[model samples]
Target chain A: MVRPVNPPASWWRSGLAVLVVLGMLPVIGNIFRNDSSVSRCEWDGQVMRPEAAVTLELAGRSVTCCDVRCARNWLASHSERPTLIQVRDEHGGDPIDSADAFFVRSAVVTNRANGNRWHVFGDRETALRHARESRGRLMRGDEHPFAGVRGLE
Target chain B: MIVNAYAILSLFVCGLQCAVAVWLTGRWLNSRRAWSSGWTDDGAEVVERNAYLMMTLALVLLGLDLASWPLLYLLLQSYVPSWPGVMCIDGVTRIGTGSLGASRFLPGLLVTLQVFKPLVMLIGGAWLVIYLANRATSKAPLMRRLLWGLLLIGVTSLCDGVCTAGYLLIPKQEDHLAAGCCTQVTSTTTTRSSEPLLAGVSGTELTVVFMLLWAGLLFLLLDSIRKQRSGRKWMGGLLAITLVVAVLGGLFLVDVLSPALLQRPHHCPYDLVSELPESVIGIVLFMAGSFWVAAGAIASFCADVPETREILPGLQARVLFLGLFSYLGSFSLLSVQWCVL
Candidate 1:
């Protein structure tokens, strides 16, 4: 086999110079953007949890969370009281509006590594119906203290 | 014509891909000494990483190229008439007219072939590189990788380019008279006011020419390989014969197997056009160019070299010639289509 080229730092500097001479391509060009926004749940700017009710708000936009872990982390850190409303979907683990939530009773809570609880509704029929019918997550009124709690009112 | 949104998007994607490749290559080069045995043969994994990165980047660009078909379909629906027989599928819906979609065995098969076309060149490049690398490690070096690579690129590029042209010219639909025969020959004198001398220049003819040119290129490639290996002349000869026969068989099969493919083209004007003189010139230019490429490929293959002389570069040159000719030939066939239909 042939010995690969192991050029010195000056070679890299020259390569960079050549690149600069060719012009900063990607940096100078417009990038392609897809129309449909399909961000992953874990990667999205939403918190995941089950017991505590907390809303995630960004500027004028707001979404709801189901757990205390979600409520604590999702709210604005600088403010004493969150001015925005947001909540997580109890069943699907997605963030949705707490006002429009439909929390189901007899929900099973699963433990997390971060001491957070993830609730799975015990009623398969209700969960299936909600999954099929609802566009977003549904949380019941008695699921958490902040389920019916008013924020930015 | 102005570049459409999709084309622009493709260009952007291509640029991004190239940028990512350059960046990734730079990073690999920097971290070469630290690479472990899982990735590279030695501590230096930069070259192997660069090759993979380059291939990935090229594949992405090719995807962008294939995406052009869907965008063109959309354009046809929105801007052009349906023309009744042709099928149209928007980006969301899957459309297949008997055998157009990926689900259908044939059209999907063709599309798949197209996707891997770049790899053919890339593989050849890798082979030449490896060959040179092995030789370089020897007590007496036989060939230089860069030289062989450049030569192959030059030759194969020519052949592939011509093949591409021929492919474009030859209508995908097996039938030549898809639009039906000329009902009226307009008596308008354009640039070239010559009588219809070329009668049998159908889509099938273009397809045959394409297949033949492709075969010739492949034959030359085999010849190059034969020169490298011992006792390979018989195998090379067999391949050459098979390729030629297959091309001929394809031409014959186009008419027999798919008779209903081409109905008589409607509004086909076999007119005395003075304006179409340039078209005749265009055909001549195409044929001449194809001939030149074929000649070069053949000549390169037959050229005798000393056992000590570097021959891979010469082989590479032949491949480039074949590529150029193939593309040019396809274009000519397309021009002929424009003339007839």
Candidate 2:
């Protein structure tokens, strides 16, 4: 638990602090609604959940989505492909280059964009365990079915 | 996304929640001394004043915390064309997520808080409702319960502080560093190796569990009303079941119902509050029902106190009815949209 907010240093100190906070703020609408050019869930055209966003670098453009499923689906359907596919690692949650990642399809994990039904993992061991548990099929980034996309190579 | 517009205000909000937690805890500790002395009428008045201030401040903070979630998204968006290549909320969120290293998890935590913030609001709202229903009960277990609730928020607010700091640390997203959308972000990453454990539980299974859990909560609500026992047993049962229902129902929302509601295969609880039509109504009903049940139970816990006994039953019944109706009502409406209608 957080320690208590200490008593204000003094009345003027409190006022100064408030002013500083106010000065740093952007417009109020930006606080409540989005103004960025990237779409929330581009696949479904809905506001993306900050928790579930699946981001990929494709076709020299950014395709931000609701989940990995949509990103994967989009990559599969598109003629132009991503130069690099960086999927968020399930364990570390750091975005990993897709070529080095492992994937599982038809798992319980739901995407915010087009419920495409897939998850990405950084290691093969965990992905294999997930397949065993969730009845998912392994999607190896190194393999063709999953890696058919190549851009301007 | 461009430093969230609300980021600065969040510092104050988080500080207030921590302060309120501290104040309430101090009061709780002091109560032992106050009890031993017995409330001299003067002491009683002072305590009452402090209690009222703490609760009111806590509620005010909760209201603000709830509002800040969306603002976090917009703050990034406002950074916009200036950021170049960063077009949407996703671009704003993912850019840092990819480069922020260990702190990348902060954005995910902020989003998960979406499920929890409303619960804090419900707990606070329930306290307000119970306080309105009976003044006499405010002195007993109700105060202790209120302190615990605030403590929960205090702890969570600290997470907010971390996330806010992390957001600040993230440099402006470069044009070459953007990612896809939320679908890719939430599904692909396993923050902890343990995440795979959640797999295999299909959407259908989650839906069944969610409905069953809510049904159990409704049963508890009905029994509380039918017996009007107002004992610890009844109240504890009610509180416990409501908690499970909320937790399970929340998972279901993220995993199954959200997709069904949008008539697509997307899942994001925050979307329920977005531009979607009538989404807020469904969310409000769910919260109303859950909070009402909680409020009624808290009131019941204080029922045995002689001063509050007379008003307890009447208030409990009304509150329970509101909670049960709204909780089930949300499910019904979603069901109609998904299946029945």
Candidate 3:
């Protein structure tokens, strides 16, 4: 018959307890570090600057994009039409409803990921002024960058 | 074949494991033969020596193999810079798809390795625990059983070594292909594939289901601990529950937590890991919890053998406690993150 031996020592149990406790230290530390202050683009996963951000309401959630191109591409892919589309004026940094905004596809790139050079302004005069200085053309209503995009139309 | 420090180290580890596994196989056969035939006085000493050597080597190799799983990902991550349009480890796996050569098979080989490595690690870890428990006894009555288990582990390790070598040595067409990154792959597939699993279940509803499964798992684990033994039926039920919980946990991470943490609307775990490294802790906790629960179930099952019955209960209780602690820790961490978000 096989004899039963005494139970093993408790060292491993203590070691495991220590490990479980140690695993929580980093998690505790992460709680204090806030990352929400910087807004990120939903389409390309890039940080969105206030001047270059394109915001839209899709499926009851606010979606932010790095530029007009990303916003258009995102809209083109999704079947649901956005309820609202808003862009920031390049000069004044004020939110402008995309319907009333003037677009300028300049040589200046706003987001490097997609090489998006499209700029938006709240008024036609500012758009024309920047277009002349940057040697760019002002886009008309039909020629707007997001004209063909499903939700933006 | 993009050569780097990580690749070189991985190849070296695999090679060493292969060699050790071969040596272990020889010792296992010898030990089995001696045990079955009933060794004489001097032969018994040799058998004992061989058993000790085999156990020591197997333990070390298993430990190394466990560590290699994470190292495999890190190695793939290192290759990202060499492959154009590859933003993360997901793209690195698709590095050589355009080529019509052995490199085209790289992704398949890596995927096989990914699946095989976890199975090998889980079995190897369970074997290690059993061996430790048996070793604590005087006569080591479980030696015969352990020898067979060791042989099984050895064969798997050898196969794993071969697969790892194949994955590393194959030359990848890095620059020409410019494989699509996670943005293209994960964005389209995650939502579509998860929809079937969700079955019209929203994220909030899934969270409730996940929490309920966790609660059930906790109850089963605590009951097992209280009884000081797990019935076979309960063990199977526990494993099933653990599997569902793990799957739902992964879905939760991909669909909800990852996007929320990254502040993006897409589902990509690679981005989450790359962007927020601390999230790895919660993942580790979840994985560890799952492993311990499985280990405890295996321990309880092993108690069926007459010789191990006396000692395995204590081991089972300890492992179950670990499982409970790990699961609770993971849940708490996720809760904290949800609150913060």
Candidate 4:
């Protein structure tokens, strides 16, 4: 077993250890909560974690998502504390809390740029209100739906 | 192909080697003190034994690593026989791409490992000199011993720092700001207004400055040898001769080989044989410098004649000083200049 060479908790070593712990905060938060709704509203490489596969427990059912963005979308309707989540969000230093969010629902012209088909709602209303505002429109019947598992209890 | 892995491993081992050398030096001093007194213990003896074992291990590791190039060639012949697989001595790619600092593209992850190889060599060289200097004290004068010890520390550090910086600054392969070693002449639209003196200078000037410093050190080494006892002068003289030969070899390549042999007919538009080849002059200078360094290194390690004690230390110190000057100076000279019309 290796012991510390100069072992009275060397100030330099302690400082370095603290710095490393602080650096790990974002990464740990990401694994606990999928901040997808906020991410979709601000989609400029700041949105979802790139190509991350996550399993989130919403309400009583288990939902598997391609990424944090998908997880956030499913979590809006299904009321539950997210278990095993991944947070991908708000890169422009914008604080994207669930409260005080704007919702805009229009047939967003799908193009190569802004590639992900996301239900963006982080403007003027909470996510739930935004979902209700869009009720029974292009987002109605599941025809060619977003490529992911949906509606976890 | 897998040179990156080899380089990283070598660097890690080099750190271990440096630590071992320091430990051994401490142990040797302790043992000498014990032996001087009447009381003696097996502990000192054990330390001495361990030191020698460590030294031997370090040498064997270096030798094995150096042998890898040949070993790869042999393996290739037995396995997938291809034209490219067979390594050519002349066209062998210089280690590490220099794109880390020189270009828009992100440097390859593996290229970073290239910086460590030269560092390992510098440490290894210094370690060898120190080990030899310790053993040669009986035959060397005080000055000679001191010089060797000083040189070992100074030269190694200089080489390590300079080579690291050069590889980072000057891309090994052809870059957009293409300078060192790659100059293709295309057009000859000579601008008459450019500073004539600065115009002649190129990236190769670093090599020239290095060569000049080395030559000066070589001369000092020769004078030190001349002062040594009658029989020991021959060793110093021989070393001086070897130094001269090596310098000449480098000069011949830079001056005669590159211009007379390597230069092809006009291909690129920017090409112009504007002043006498500055690179050739630089090569000759560096060659002279390398010769002196090698000579000093050998003499410090080998000579132990009765009257040469003082001379050994001085020679060692000169070697160390010159080694550093050449290594860093060469890189600096190359970094600041480039191919132009």
lDDT per residue as tens, model 2, B1-341: 33344656654555554555555556545543564577698666655666666566566656666666555554554543344333334444444354435445645655665545665666556666556554555446455455556555555554554555555455443322335663233322211111212467987787788787788777877666555546767787888888788777777777776656544444554444443434445566787777778777766654345666766775676677667667655655555445421
Model 3 RMSD in Å is: 6.0
The runs of at least 3 residues in candidate 3 whose Cα sits more than 4 Å from the true structure, single-residue gaps closed, are A1-39, A47-63, A76-143, A148-153, B30-43, B97-99, B174-201
For lDDT, candidate 1 versus 4, the one ahead is: 4
Q: Please give each candidate's TM-score.
A: 0.24, 0.53, 0.77, 0.29
lDDT of 3 at B60: 72
Q: How do the residues B156-227 of candidate 3 rate in per-residue lDDT, one tens digit apiece?
A: 888888888888888774324334763232221112111223546777888788889889898888777666
What does the lDDT read for residue B185 in candidate 2? 34
In candidate 3, the residue pairs with backbone N, CA or C atoms under 3 Å apart (3 or more residues apart, or in different chains) clash, namely B1-B171, B1-B172
Q: Clashes per prediction?
A: 68, 50, 2, 46
Maximum-DockQ candidate: 3
Worst 10 residues of 3 chain B by lDDT: B185-194
Q: After superposition, how far is residue B126 of candidate 2 from its true place, in Å?
A: 4.8
For A29-136, candidate 2 gives per-residue lDDT tens digits of 234445465455655555665544666676557776666765666665456566776567666677777677777885665642244567678788998898889988
Instruction: Report the number of the highest-TM-score candidate.
Output: 3
Model 4, residue B303: what's the lDDT? 52
Q: What DockQ does each candidate score versus the true complex, computed on alpha carbons?
A: 0.01, 0.04, 0.21, 0.01
lDDT of 1 by residue, B22-135 (tens): 453454444444443444555334544444454354344334434433333333233212222221221111112243323233244334434434433343434443343344
Indicate whether candidate 2 or candidate 3 has the larger lDDT: 3
Q: A46-151 in candidate 3: lDDT tens per residue?
A: 6678888988887768888888988887776667677788999888789988888999988876654456778898888888988899888899777887676565
Q: In what order do the candidates fall by TM-score, top score first?
A: 3, 2, 4, 1
Which residue runs of candidate 2 sit more than 4 Å off their true CA positions? Answer: A1-153, B4-49, B69-102, B108-119, B133-198, B219-223, B226-229, B270-277, B302-304, B339-341
